[model samples]
Target chain A: MMESDINWNSIYEILTGPALWFTFIFFVGGLLIRLAFLFRLSRKKDRVIYNHFSLAWGLRSIFQWMIPWASASMRQQPVFSIVAFIFHLSLLAVPLFLSAHIVLWEEAFGVRLWSMPDGLSDGLTLIFIAAALFLIARRRIRPEVRILTSAWDYALLGITMLPFITGFLAYHQWGPYEVLLILHILFSQILLILIPTTKLGHMVLFFLTRAFIGFEMGGRRGARSW
Target chain B: MTSPTKKKFEFENNTDAPVDVDRVRAILNANDGARIRTWLSICSRCGLCAESCFVYVANDRDPRLSPAYKFSHTLGEMYRRKGKVDRAFLEKCYQIAWLQCTMCKRCSMYCPFGIDVATMIAVARSVCHSQGITPKQLAFFSDHCDKTGNHMGIPVEELVDTCEWMVEEVEDDYEGVTIPIDQPDAKYMYTVNPREPVYYPQDISYAAIIFAAAKESWTMPTFGWDCTNLPMFAGNRTLAGKQVKNVYDKAQELKAQHILITECGHAYRSMAFEGPYMAGYPDGKPPVKIKHYVQLLHEYLRDGRIQIDSDKKIKEPITYQDPCNVSRNGGLWEQARKIIPYIAEDFRDMAPNREHNHCCGGGGGIMPMGPDYKPYRMASGKLKADQIKATGAKFVITPCHNCFDQINDLSEEYDLGVKALSFKEIIVEAMIVPDHLKLECEK
Candidate 1:
């Protein structure tokens, strides 16, 4: 009924409709292309990996790294290891199983999946925010970390944290709730689009690398990469 | 600082060498395999690799010494610039690749993605090597390998002469001990680091004593006697390949069942694991079975081929320096550990020993890089010094010549008051000489 309300509604509609679809396609398709390219390149240039490939070693390498304190390096830097594991866990869980996110996915796909309890999701979101800030502070405070940190690293971190921050604020009605929701969707889409184009590609590339190294070190050399 | 009175081996930078952009691009393109491309693409620079790097920890935790920073700034920058990097940039790459990191792969275990930073450093070295931008000492050794089939440029005649020399010394203790040269159909065709023949002929005598005591059917190859491939450390892969092939072909020619490498770390890694791959064997296997000295030592003790005299076992506290190539890359850590307890009464394992052990900072051909690098080398070796000091062991035994030399220097510099030794040195002391092999004086 109000003019500003109508303006926000139209903007929200576009972001959720065609814009959201475009972001989803770009994210999934770009990642698939990257995976395909790396696979083809590996086949051509590094046949040694395929020759020595072992599913057992590869899976073991991945799982060992997945568990906290399973690696000596992880054990050496206890704080960083704990924070990193928690940060990654929250990054994956909150995005997929948060009730609001599930509702959106179900609405768009006409499909439904289990959603985590709202309280738990909220707690994870807060943890994600805190972990992200801690990581940024570490990058700033630690000399070894500080020298490697670039403006781009800080920018990427900001991009990753914005959606959660805005969502939290919007959920508790801290500011213009509709504006915050729209900004949240926008930031989430931006983050998705950037995944395949930036260092965030590690989300998937990590597994392939772990597997390759696992084969080279474990299967061939009888040495564990992890 | 190196004393001016001490002759410098010179870092051997060809400052006058022309930096051909085409050559740079070609080298980068050739090395830009899936591993490099993907690894360069995905490093988020989380800097967890800092603590994993001994150099970083040793150099007052300098971030520039971080393994991630080292490779990322060197090869990653080269790839980012599409190999259009200038001579100045390539010089920096040379410093980072050769001087900063040891290519030990300790950081590889720490990387969340399991990124092989050592591989990247190798590639970076290759790139620098293309432009005549390598440490002079390593380059000279690589050239020696190319010219004489050994790192020290020792001719086949000299290798035979040294074996004879070692035989004369060993024969006084073990009557029948002989350093057999180029014998055909031997069970194991043994090889030595060129350093043994040049600086430490006693090591050859020790090997002869062990073989005599064990009655091991081993023969040394006259032409391919040198197992260590400094070319690999020099980043000259072609030369490295040829060096490995010499030993591999010699073993094949002799009809030897196995090629037994000496108590050297890089020699085992280059000759066993990396050499076949460099020589175009994708499966990473040479035709003949390759065995490290550690593996053979373990086998001899386990099968009772050579018995360790209980009374002669080392009584003082001792520790084993796990060479990166021998333990981490070669996976003979358990074998080395098993050998230690058999030969020593008290064995104190270094904290973060085995696959996770820090490099002694003399690898990647740094020891061969000579006196100019001694200052930085000793500085980087501080972590290893501290590790040795913590064990409070009087004897620091290593299966690697590079590690032995570096640990010796660390002891001298850090005042650790430890005697650096090799596996052969300990075994020769503890091994019981057989009745038949014992000299008449002892009998």
Candidate 2:
């Protein structure tokens, strides 16, 4: 079909309907399966008992290390931490608060929420792009990180940044508006599909990994991992 | 300084050794649980864990020695290969998991993702052990423990003789004191690292002095007297389980209410924490209470069971080395800090004290790797040596025996002019025995 003759309604329906649900199912279901597998594996015959168990301590570690200046990792690598903090903050904020995302959520679940100003959303998207560039540059320049940088690591970074880039272009109508919108939806969908399977799984696994270490260090070892 | 008396075996250069890819794969497959999978998938290669590792830092930030790199290359590679690795690669895995890394868990403390890199390395060691590709010394020590119930292979007669010798020394210094051995119905059964009797017999004497001063009813069993478990470090889980089970059974047979592990970090961690788990006990809880001597010393001081003559203090500045096992892993940092000030007038804290302290490079059974690996091991302890040097302390007190040995080596190698002493030794030097318990000549 010609680009102008394409039926936009059907495409939007497919993108928001079966495709969205599929991504959600795969992301959530795959996560649950992985978590269950980890729990089962931990139940081996010979298990070391951690004498101390403090839910408060574990939770404290989670929040304590979440801040930019709260952890030694952040202090040791300030530039990376700043970029990473902004990247993660924008990654979460721009998606959840953008007017378009709020509209989608309202339509899907019949819930209305506050939306971020378009200017703020645009600025966050720009920061996200800049952070992604810095991370890529770091991977290329820093010898230690350079050695560990694999093809998949670069691909994950590219895949994650694509949606934001396309979404920004579409919002400003800088590129072909119709094509950019379609590409944004497609890229986001690809990310969702890859979330549980690839390094993108960090999005879900971060909490579990942090909690495990926190509980281990706080309750059992009587110290914080941070 | 001193070289290990045992001759080194040339395992790494022996390329003719057979490779058991199937057995390696089986072990890898068995260990491919959620923990390993999550860690492998989640690490973002941030390189933050490098600073936390003494080996990585001491090696001038070499990426190859970083905890992340070590795990990714060895365990991560094994997973990628599905354990169908060649003999040469397995040998490299042995070096990375066993020799290079001390499995100190300090990296876990600094990891943003909180990944337990040490556990991953231990899993790699387990795979190596299955393939008969372990360090010769570690394997020999494991075999010794399996055959003779102690790493040193001290016969019961020799063990009794050593105890009598220690008892005689203690009696010569102080009256009305005894080293009770094989005494049933004691409140606590005290255990020692085999090296104590073999190389540092004075450690036994120091412990005897403390027990006598406290007037505690404790026994040292002839069987299962050694608490150090080489199998734990070698990642021989079955053998580790057997070793722990032997100690537990001995404690049960003697009807001791508690098992007091000496100033050995890994021994305390293995017995009180890992042992019960290895022996199929739920939550790793032993049949009886497991206590470290540091904890006991702290308690004894608090309860007035033992008195430290704060007046009789060390003349020079002193600092404490937090054992990775006892402080970071066992949460006994505060106890040592609390007990040190009472004994030393010039107690100074290491800048990154407590859980963040560097490993002494003697952990993970690296000490038993012998002289062939000593230069490398001592080199990896550069950060620790620097930390000690910066403190400018004349004495470095560490509660763990492995730390004691490693710190002593670091002191001698770096020419820091410091003496390494265990907490028990410090206590004996500074403790005040009552006149009633003192011998007439000494009084």
- The chain B TM-scores of all candidates, as shown, are 0.96, 0.95
lDDT values, one for every candidate: 0.87, 0.84
Q: Which candidate is the best by DockQ?
A: 1
TM-score of chain A of each: 0.95, 0.91
Model 2: residue B255 alpha-carbon error in angstroms: 1.0
lDDT, candidate 2, A36-146, per-residue tens:
776677665213313444567667778867898788767878888888989999998998899989988998778988999999999999999999999999999887788
lDDT of 1 by residue, B1-443 (tens): 12223442344575765678788798888877788888888888889888999888888887788888898799889888888888778877877888788899988888888899998899889888888888888888888888999989998777788888888776556788887778999999999888889899898888888888888898988888788988898888888889999999999999999999999999898887888988777776787899998988999999999888999998999999999999888888999999888999999999888888889999988888887788878988988999999999999989999999899898999999999888888888888777988768888
Tens-digit per-residue lDDT, B1-443, candidate 2: 12232444455234566778888877887777666788898899878787788887887777777788999999999999887788778777877887679988988878888889988998898887777777877888888899998988889999899988988877767877778898999988999999989898888888888888888899999998888888988878889988988888999999999999999999988897778767777765788888999999999988988888877878799999999889998999999888887788898888788988888888988888777788777878888899999998999998888888888898899999988888887788888887766989877
RMSD of 2: 2.9
Please provide TM-scores, in order, for all candidate models, with all chains considered together.
0.96, 0.95
Report the Cα lDDT for residue A166, model 1. Answer: 94
Model 1: how large is the Cα RMSD against the reference? 2.3
TM-score of the B chain in model 1? 0.96
